[model samples]
Target: MPAFTIVTTSATQDSDAAEVNTLTDDFGSETEALGYSRRMADEMLGLAAQLSLDFDYSNVALYDGDLLEEDLDPDHPALIGVWVLDEEGCSYVPAAEFRESLAEPEA
Candidate 1:
């Protein structure tokens, strides 16, 4: 089960969970995966527009889905997909970054 780095552009610095559009599906090839991810970006941008979101630069650019396999470990327990709060907004980090952010309980 491969994972993807989904990106979304937004105007407001704050966007709730509902405003974030996520996708979880495997495709035939890597190209297709990226294509689908970009399409999802379009959907998200449209959504932002409907919500009347405004960006500071009047330019919002979301990232296209990219297969991140550089430092990903499927066996890691903390590699779950979840968004974390940032200065810009809530966004998903890479698998390794997510693991580093976790606070493990004392042994």
Candidate 2:
């Protein structure tokens, strides 16, 4: 069984409702999972910015066009984080802080 799970969610804004998509990946360690989360978060942020969506972590959305854009809530589905699976159950690390935990201390 995998030791960790990485979950990513994407949403396309619509007139009255939004289309949400979710994907999950399994990894063997927290380090590996966090590395993936950081990269994925960067890519999503880039995409949002390329579409001129502000990427304010509370007002950005990605669409299916060549590069669609819209305003999203703070709980935007741009990038997700890793979930640790243990004997008890699972724990989530929000996307906003996933990379922080993995960062190297500065001198």
TM-scores for all candidates: the values are 0.37, 0.40
Please give the range of 10 consecutive residues that has the lowest summed lDDT in model 2. Answer: 58-67
Q: Summarize candidate 2's per-residue lDDT along 1-107 as a digit string, tens digits.
A: 24333333433333343333333445655566566655665665566557754321111122111112333222445434444322232345565665565464857
Clashing residue pairs, candidate 2?
none
- Please give the lDDT score for candidate 1: 0.42
Go through the candidates in order and give each one's C-alpha lDDT: 0.42, 0.41
Q: Report the C-alpha lDDT of model 1 over 11-105, residue by residue, as the tens digit.
A: 35543423333344555654565566545545555665677664321121122233333332333442333333333543444545545545555
- List, in order, the clash count of every candidate structure: 0, 0
Q: Please give the range of 10 consecutive residues that has the lowest summed lDDT in model 1.
A: 55-64
Looking at model 1, the pairs that clash are none
How well does candidate 1 score on lDDT at residue 94?
Answer: 52
